[model samples]
Target: MNYTELKARHRSERENYASNALSLRLHRALSWLNKAEQVEDDDSKFIFLWIAFNSAYAQESGQKHYDTERERYIAFIERLVSLDSEKKLYNLVWSQYSSNIRSILNNQFILADYWRFQSGDIKENAWIEAKNKAMKAAHTALAHNDTTTVLSIILSRLYVLRNQIMHGGATYGSGANRQQLADCSALMFDIVPLFIELMMAGQHQVWGDAAYPLIEH
Candidate 1:
């Protein structure tokens, strides 16, 4: 196909996928979580919570390189921060979920041995320490294919938490697991938007430079 035709196709596909699939799924997941919170039955709440968590996990970490590619995802995150540094939406998300992210980092039960290994006796900011450990784990995983190290990363934390709950590691009424689920839901709500924005930016960079630009909206 010609460049013009190819670009148009790309735009059409991206718009359809974003609107039809990504946005729809995200909306449904969030809606489910909202409804789930209202229920008094712990089993029902846990089931719906797991649905939301799995939805976010699939979108965020289902990519091929997400688990294996250290530098690529790190660079993507860095670029996202740089691009949206002054944007109010980004700042708002950060303000709301920054503590939630830290909580995920500090959760020993969810992280298990990975937590014991990385947290150590250091007394640093939880968020900073978590970020460092995740990055280091990513690097190690990419280099050595270490499952434990890979599981220590942020994406892995999200995935593992979902797995643990979905696979019966934690009971429905468990206070600790429920808190972790809530935190994951909040973190996903913030981080998913950033991931979508980064993806759009990457596509724009590619097609824009080729003289067939993507629509910003």
Candidate 2:
């Protein structure tokens, strides 16, 4: 239906699913995504999309020293990848979205440059190295530490951009900043639905039969 009607329906759905932190966060993210879609200005779209990304990313990253719904989701992804049943899905996601992920990571220019310098350059392995550096920065930036493996750098970079904009270090409209906003908006357009799907999967994995029911009253 129309944007207003869709938003109202989503709000109702969110109210039904607000029993847990994860559900609440998912609904909030979706609401922001809807707003992002409706906004006319690139800057406004960027902010709403960033908010959407941040809401989902926070749920996925969780807090240090605590078992989170995201942890369970990761575990589930690991299992699926190992079993080959979900390998194609994972591969598809990576192949389709990895470039946008890298774009977001590179927006954290200082961190990205440092990682590139330290990692050394191999022309053939540029993508691999970029992924490595992005992962490193994601862990450092988000978890405030180091990680050998990259889990969610894509989402983490969005978080980084959100911080830059929210902290007033970066302007949202015009010139280079405008392009940055555009890039993030495009990336969010691709990933927001995926993030929502992942969160829904996590909810099911963590809550089993009691997972948030998907129905309308």
Candidate 3:
């Protein structure tokens, strides 16, 4: 959506929004997340970005943000109901922490075989397990079945790339590996923005003009 133009438009408003201590943190965080998205290669970064964005959103609005955000997603509905620990909305705060969940899972899956292979103990099954769990958690948290295939494939591809980075080579063969790498890059760059919309209640996109998917659930 012409991020440069939009950022220029909101620069003054954001600067004014930053005058308050909370908004100030949010302003800094929005900038940080923007930068993180540009170079983020791991789940840790996504986790950090999600936390920063979610906190900023919470501070910017209120508990209602959680509800509205949950309503936008298919799976988070039940989780949201169970997350209102502060009794903010309806005693459901789990959904409130969904972003954090995604970040952790993303990181874990990405490191799958690499962590073990680096330790000189490459258990293919273990790697598969980690990748599987992360995919299930991520897709489940997203609560959208349509994306299950793409997200799983993309996440696995990214994990494999990290695996290669850690091992300095490829055991999954070159052609397949390169294809997966390209797919992973596409998935990360393309899907992450839609993900942000689903995760943050009021956060705006910084990269594109894509419309949110029409979710019925």
lDDT of each model, Cα atoms only? Answer: 0.50, 0.53, 0.41
lDDT by residue for model 2 over 41-126, one digit each (tens)? Answer: 77788788767755654533323333754454454334333434333435434554456545656654423343355457434356
- Report residue 196 deviation for candidate 2 (angstroms): 1.0
- Candidate 1 per-residue C-alpha lDDT over 107-172 given as tens digits, one digit per residue, 9 for 90 to 100: 665664554455584434664566567656555544563332332355456666766766777776
Measured by lDDT, the strongest candidate is: 2
lDDT of 2 at 12: 52
* TM per candidate: 0.44, 0.54, 0.35
> Superposing every Cα of model 2 onto the true structure, what RMSD results?
9.2
lDDT of 2 at 87: 38
Q: Model 2 Cα displacement at 95 (Å)?
A: 3.9
**Can you tell me which runs of candidate 3 are displaced by over 4 Å?**
19-111, 144-177, 191-217
Misplaced by over 4 Å in model 2 are 1-20, 57-92, 97-151, 205-217
Off by over 4 Å in 1: 1-98, 114-153, 205-217
Ranked by lDDT from best down, the candidates are 2, 1, 3
How big is the RMSD of model 3?
A: 13.5
Better candidate by lDDT, 1 or 2: 2
What pairs collide in candidate 1? none
